[model samples]
Target: MSQWFQYDRRIFKYFNYLLVIQIIPLLAISSYLINEINPLLFKKQMLYYGIGAIAFLVTTFIPWRKLIWWFAPLFYTMNLLLLLAVDLVGKTILGAQRWIEIPGTGLTMQPSEFVKVSVIMMLAYLISKKPPLEQGYGLVGFIKLSLVILIPFLLIAKEPDLGTALVLLITGYGILFVIGINWKIWLVLAVAVGLSAPVLFSHLHDYQKKRITDFLGQPSYPVHQALIAIGSGGVEGKDKDEATQTQLKFLPISSIDFIFAYLGERLGFHGMVTVIILYILLILHLFYIAIRN
Candidate 1:
């Protein structure tokens, strides 16, 4: 018991309190927004918050650095198998077949979400084993790294969860960009992507293609409504009675993807700026910590 207590104390001694402090304001604002929009969802969000806190605490107890080399590959393989299982027996939610339902619990888990963590761990493990040279990774190294990212990218994109898949793809490359990849390799990849754009577009689902078309041309239905919500708010914003776009359900999917529109309508330009600044600060802080460590 004394040894366990010492271990806990040692972990706490190096805990990053500043990171936790920065996250609190964001969580507080989200809770307030959810509470105002729907009291029931707010209650559920609180429960999720509790689960997240416990998860964070549990993760802190893990000896990550010590075990990462051996554990990462096993973890990554397990997640990949789970991703494959989704194709055979995944649950469909709102047109996307991206979740696996747990037996008898009426609960579904999204393997793509877990894939993000495993990918990062696998990347860390691989990179640590064969770090970049001063000129950065050569063709062989780059291909190995790209395969780590692209395998999962293809799987998730096959799920037609393009948004999440693209985010993962971008983030994976972004890490490579920071860690160092050969500049010639990047130029070649860019040219290759440009040449293949049409082929890629041809493979996308109709709705996904429509989204691209709408984005490049006119705004889509939900987007147009979101614009109205924002425009109606002006510079100062509107009262609860006046914010009819969200209040009267004109703003489509206001609780999820379009919550930013709801935020703009509720608090206008200044609020948007404030939230953006907070996000910038959080991102910059993270970058600083990553570079420092």
Candidate 2:
């Protein structure tokens, strides 16, 4: 008990307070909205949040360097297997097969989220151990990292989660940058991405492409409704009951991806700004911790 208390004290003393601050607001807003919608769902979500928080806190005390080295390959392989399993027996939701149901628990495992974290850890470990940045670590390291990244990237894209795939790419590139990879390589990659944009656009699933097009002002039911919600907010929001009714009636994804929209309708522009500020601060805090460590 003494050792555990010491451990907690050391970790929390240096814990990212800004991140905690940001997360609290997000949780508060999400919980409030969820509770207003369905008390049972809010309770279930809180339970899940608690379990995740406990797991994270417990893992924090384990030396990150040791953990990263020991679990990198294991995590990478496990995510690969999970992705394969997802392909075989995953539950499909809203046209995406990205979750696997755990028998008896009634809980679904989203391997893609796990894949992101694992990929980040693995790359950070590998790159940290790479040859001097000035020496150009040869094609071998680049190839290995590319393969590691592509496996999950392709799998998640197959799950039809473009947002997640993009995030993986960004995280991989961010790790590479942190490891002092040359700017010229990044420049070339950026150019390649630009060059491939048209081909990528052509390959996107119709609805996937349509969502981007809709966001850019193409006529679509989802975009139309989202705009209405935003516009209706009008600097200040309607009452909670009215907001819930409006959201349930119009907003397609009032609970998930479009939760921001729901919040905007219910809490108005100031609320949206607060949420965005929290996200920004949280990201900055994580970056600070990553750099310091």
Candidate 3:
């Protein structure tokens, strides 16, 4: 245990540093914008951020491999249960049944996020356990790994979290490739994916289909609103009052997924560039550790 701690000290240090460098500036910018628009919302965002940071730090300090291996099945099961629970009793927000409210705690949980990390960890473990590609067992191992990944992929896709489910599929395929899945199999899957796109599109909900169609410039208010936000940001963006109003009124999803757009509007080109560089550095550092391990 002590040796594990000693070995991970450097990793923990870098993780904290990366968190501070990447998150603090983003939070500061977000808080500033939020404060300008709505002080109460800004305070709530900060409190949520603080709680999330503490949870993140705790997870980082623990040995991920041990946690994954020890609790992978339990974690996976719990998340599945939560996802089911959400379907039965979850709060509806923005037309998605992706969040569940916990009574007494007054907190909403997003089970899909937990599922993402669980899937990644499980994949990592399975890949680590497998023999080299030269071994005769590689094909069988690959099939088993595919099953492990596909189950959650289908479940989350059912939740209709297209973006995250796609991310999971990509990351799973990436891990399999890293563990030496044959290129021929990848080619087959690529062809299958290509063939299935039309069918997949047909299966999507009306709004989901519209989002894709709108991306292709089919008529849609959502698309127009998004374009307006982008256009308003301009090459250098609007002045402070304009930026604040744009956020408060115009920019939908200003706090979460579209936070980058908000950052671009207020901080302009230089700030966006800085944020990208910081992310690149942090990702490189994480990759370095993964490779070293």
Candidate 4:
């Protein structure tokens, strides 16, 4: 018991408390949004939280660094295989075939999500063992690194989940950028990306192009409605009965994507400021941990 207590204390001492602190507001906001939508969903969300908490504890207790080094490639390969399997034996929903249904079970999962973590683990394993030179990673090293990132990026992109693929691509490169890369390499890459932007844009799926065009042209359906909700929020917010935009469901899926606007409509500018402040604090805290660690 004493040994377990000591272990728990050490974990707590190093754990990112500030990041954990934000969970309170996150849960509160999520609960509020779901509660307003469907009371039963709030109950289901709590159950999900219970399962997620256990998963968090399990991952937190694992000695991830050594495991990441030894198993990253194997884990990443498995993730890629699962991604490939999606096309062969995957389930399709919402017009995109991104999910794989587990055999003999009702559960389904998106492999692309898992791929993100594995990519990071693989990158950390590679770069930590082979630190970038002062001039940064040479062409040979760059190709090796790029191969690690691009394989998953291409696979996910082929899944027709460009949003997630771009996120993975950006995040992988962002990690590289933060860990330090040659300025010359970054400059050339940036120029190449800039030159290739149109070509890349042309190859995008029609829906993807539409989304981009809409963003560049005018705020689309949800954005327009969310903006209305925000504008109506003003300084002080409205009551549940008075918040017509959200209450009447003018802003659909507000709980997921436009929660900020719904929050603005409900609690007004002050609530928005508070959430923004919490996020800013969390980011700063993360940077502090990064530098300190």
Predicted model with the maximum lDDT: 1
lDDT per residue as tens, model 3, 1-293: 66444346666556546546666665676687677656776776767888987886666556766566667767767777777777688787887777888788666777888888777777766666655556332556778888877877777777667777788888887777876766667778789989999998898888788777777877566445555665567677666677753546666666565666666676677767877887787778778867887
1-293, model 1: which lDDT tens digit per residue? 43322235566798778888888988887777767777777886787679888987776666666668789999999999998999999999888899998798555679999999888889989999999999999999998998999999999999979999998999899989988999999999999999999998898899999999999999998999999998888888888678899888888768778888888898899877888899999999998988899
**Highest-scoring model, TM-score:** 1
Each model's Cα RMSD: 2.6, 3.1, 3.8, 3.3
lDDT scores of the candidates, listed in order: 0.87, 0.79, 0.71, 0.84
Task: Kindly give the stretch of ten consecutive residues in candidate 3 with the minimal lDDT sum.
Answer: 130-139
Clashing pairs in 4: none
**Once model 3 is optimally superposed onto the true structure by TM-score, how far is the C-alpha of residue 258 displaced, in angstroms?**
3.2
Q: Give residue 190's lDDT in candidate 3 (0 to 100).
A: 89
lDDT of residue 291 for candidate 1: 88
After superposition, the stretches of candidate 1 with alpha carbons farther than 4 Å from their true spots are 1-11, 38-40, 103-106, 239-242
> Model 2 — TM-score against the truth?
0.87
Model 3 CA deviation exceeding 4 Å by range: 1-19, 34-45, 56-68, 135-139, 218-220, 233-240, 244-248, 283-293
Better of 1 and 2 by lDDT: 1
Reference-based TM-score of each model: 0.88, 0.87, 0.79, 0.86
